[model samples]
Target: MKSTLNSTSESATAAIFLSAVLFCFAPVCSGEESSNKRTGEDIYKQFCSSCHVAGGNTAKPSKPIAGSKVLKSIATFQEYLENPPGHMPYYKTVVNDKSMVRKLYEYCKKLKQTQGA
Candidate 1:
């Protein structure tokens, strides 16, 4: 019985260690691969909202891009705005760097959440 208890404790400890490692490294690695480091929210405001009009882009092919219709849900919106297509013009030349891109992503995500669309 004591041996079984020890084994269970060891498993629990390993699980906790793995979880901590994942939680810590997830954000770090995510920052590495992505081009635009700005949070989705900042990126949207800097590039999308200004001309998007009503916080939504209705310029052409992509109509009212910054709205609820743009994304099925709030969480999804955050993910999509992170890497806008080339049609939108690459922020790399302007924003450059990865960290800035992440911030931009965060900003755009916030705009969508606040605009309620």
Candidate 2:
């Protein structure tokens, strides 16, 4: 009888643990299901960093591309990134991972205020 009770208790605990794991991941999965936009910092890191790094400690670009006329007009950095100059491979495929672009935009906006970005 004691063994039977222990087994049932273990099963119950396992069920609760599984439920928590599913619940924790639910919001993250749902948010990413519909989008692939990268945050701004992601754009900076993935695309801009190489050139910008050589430019200086400041995140400013060599040719001032960050605040350039082209990057400014677009509501989303993703749109700009989707079709960078001919040299830049279109991320339309690499960026297929959901919400990557959206998160990248958020990260870009953060670099302005936070060094962690």
Candidate 3:
């Protein structure tokens, strides 16, 4: 009888510990999922709007994002973001994930199209 009680107690303790561990990580996992679900426009507005207003480069008028050759392909766009030049800051960390880079690229392309570039 004593052995049975001990085993039951141990089982309950393990179950509680597992539940607590999962609970602690649930919010982090959900937050990441929600962030990933954000659209391309959402990402652009949040991160790029200040520098590239309406798809135009406020700092460098000549090198506007609209109709830029950099947006011609995903590879080029990723490379530019990873290793930006001039006043542009490096976005390697911001666009660390491939899906995020693709989302930003698509948003920029849409901007180009809308601007008649």
Q: Which candidate comes out best when scored by lDDT?
A: 3
Using TM-score as the measure, the top candidate is: 3
Q: Where's the lowest-lDDT run of ten residues in candidate 3?
A: 108-117
lDDT of 1 by residue, 7-30 (tens): 999999999999988987875665
Error of 1 at 62 (Å): 4.9
Which residue segments of model 1 deviate by more than 4 Å? Answer: 1-46, 67-87, 113-117
Superior by lDDT: candidate 1 or candidate 2: 1
The residue-level lDDT of candidate 3 at 16 comes to 100
After superposition, candidate 2 runs with Cα above 4 Å error: 1-4, 20-39, 54-62, 75-79, 93-117
Against the true structure, candidate 3 has what lDDT? 0.82
Name the candidate, 2 or 3, with the larger TM-score value: 3
By TM-score: ranked, best first: 3, 2, 1
| Model 1, global lDDT | 0.55
Model 2 scores a TM of 0.45
What lDDT score is found at residue 60 in candidate 1?
48
In order, candidate lDDTs are 0.55, 0.53, 0.82
Q: Each prediction's TM-score against the native?
A: 0.36, 0.45, 0.68
Q: Write the residue-wise lDDT of candidate 3 on 22-117 in tens digits.
A: 987875555564557779888888788887889988777778887899998999999898889999877654568888888888889887533323
lDDT minimum window of 10 residues, candidate 1: 108-117
